[model samples]
Target: MKKTMKTTTPITKTLAAAGLAGILMISASGLPSAHVHAETKAAASTNRVTAPTVAPQLVTSKTLQSKEKWLETNIKIPVFQGLTDTKYQDQLNDIIESHASKDMDKWEKEAAEAAANAQKNGYTMHPYQLTINYELTSDGKDDSLISLKVITEGIGMNNGDPRVDTYNFTNEVEAQRVTLEDLFGKDYKSIVDKAVKTAIAADQDQYFANEDGFQSIDAEQSFYVADGKAYIVFQKYSIAPGSTGTPEFAIKLPGKGSDKKPAAAVVKSGAYYKDKNGKIMVQVSVLRQLQFNVKWNGKSKTTEISKGAVWSAVKLNKDAYTLGKMAPRSLGSAPVMKKGHIYVPLAFLTDVLNLNADHSKHGQITVTAAK
Candidate 1:
């Protein structure tokens, strides 16, 4: 993502928006004045789990002319989970100071504006709400976790109103702390392999052979498993006026609901699943609709899906080609079949079912069973 200065100014109060609080106090002859009061405050709360409220204090007050240079300060340093208060404060202070020099006034103005807008809309805005959390890893180090919440007041505007627009930016960065001491007798890799195999087997039974009977003409071309997910690639060798050889279709499978009827499936386009090595395992397909029903053991379980939903199943096969890397790029583009496995684009499968691809690296791709 490209970082640029925000075009709109954030709302803020008067003098606070200007860099007047921390400027130097000087006499008429440009001599530094000795009568400057730098207000400071230190308070604590009994509850650590809840957010603490802190009153703002004047760090410095003088009549000196403002310069273009940014003034840096360490507002608060939280030390927890085996981290020293001073060290943590120093590190945070350094980061703030370094970034502050770039455009301190700009940031200050943005912060003030944001606060004012938040209040005008009847929402409470507190500087302390910007508190960040850091976790101390086993390596005796700490990493910052960016977590903030934005609250806005309710509006009575109609459906299409821009005044209610509020953007909340939260950064939940993963910590890079892995321990090798727990790998003594545990075959972590093998465990993952077994999981992948089980997922493939389940998917094959679900999509290929359901109670409705096998819809695939060629069992080998119908479904296959790689990694830990399943993949079902099918093609309709026909075309319509404006459509390509792959006409649009829908996948109606049994939903997990009690209705016992097929519900609309949601599939995402683009890369869906990956392998243990972060290699793309699912590719796009040209087929309009390819349905993968959920099956437990050997019975259909009312769930429906597309090929991209099962990339984990495909990655388990060592011989399976990583989707997109070696497979055809487009439908009617080239043959995706190699040996006995079928290679289809994940996008085609996802589009048919109206599902979004599971692009998350560590999150589960939820597939709802048909109703």
Candidate 2:
């Protein structure tokens, strides 16, 4: 019989939940071999005994600070114990440490430049900051496998871009890096491509135009496994606006997506036309297919769509819409009354519902779920 296992917990989420601020980065010893098989044999019988788990440890480095440059650094590097092959462990640590050091050096110079510029220009500046943190996402039983993320964040400098490096290793005589193909087979790209497109289509407002923003995952794309699922990660602003930060797409492989079926497609059509601003305006009734209850208050000249606890109301001829308890945001275009029926922008309505529009196929619009 075949067997597979993976586990991980991202520390960023934990810190965020605790209301801790600042970003993280990691460094390691060296790079290991580039080849690692994804499969391992199970015991002959289910009753076979197993040994106690030997987990990896996090070793904190001495905090480094430069008062003149207004910069400070903090890092936590990983160390593996009791492994027959410690080469990979050491190399992983090296990689994390090296990355953190390089980043700090680069940011330190930039911070100094910013400080001089601020002094010359007679202005105050925020102090430069750097932090490196790691998330030990998963360690297979008996130390068969190890997976983790090296998170790096820089602040108050010239383009302190956030970065995450994923490392997957096999605890054997020789350590090897795990590739996407090893995790999901040869058709990995197709699976990831579909998920990426689906995600962008679902959240159109968050991403730039698809044609220019993202095409597909590269052969050496960064990824990590956690909680029985794999996540494909893109750098900040690579596929979306800066507000989106780093974009991640979660995909379940055969062991993942096989059990659950895709959501049924919902199709609906209404008279649509390009407005003066070139926005697609459709009949308000189309929202019904999205499971939104539309109501019109003739006296107040308002239209409201409610679904459970989430509700949005917009006044006729107004370019603002109230979503639940949040402040009003622009609808881009105001809803208008045409022949006693309400018409709204297709983009606005679909965005509010968190769905995507597909005009590639039939004349009708097909809505799909987003991340």
TM-score of every prediction relative to native: 0.16, 0.52
TM-score of 1: 0.16
lDDT string, candidate 1, 112-148, tens digits: 6666677799986544112111111111110111111
Q: Candidate 2, residues 144-164: lDDT per residue as tens digits?
A: 345666667777765667766
The list of candidate 1 runs beyond 4 A from truth reads: 1-110, 116-128, 137-371
Where does candidate 1 have its weakest 10-residue lDDT segment?
Answer: 24-33
lDDT of each: 0.23, 0.55
Question: Candidate 2: global Cα-lDDT?
Answer: 0.55
Report the number of the highest-lDDT candidate.
Answer: 2
Counted clashes in each candidate structure: 45, 19
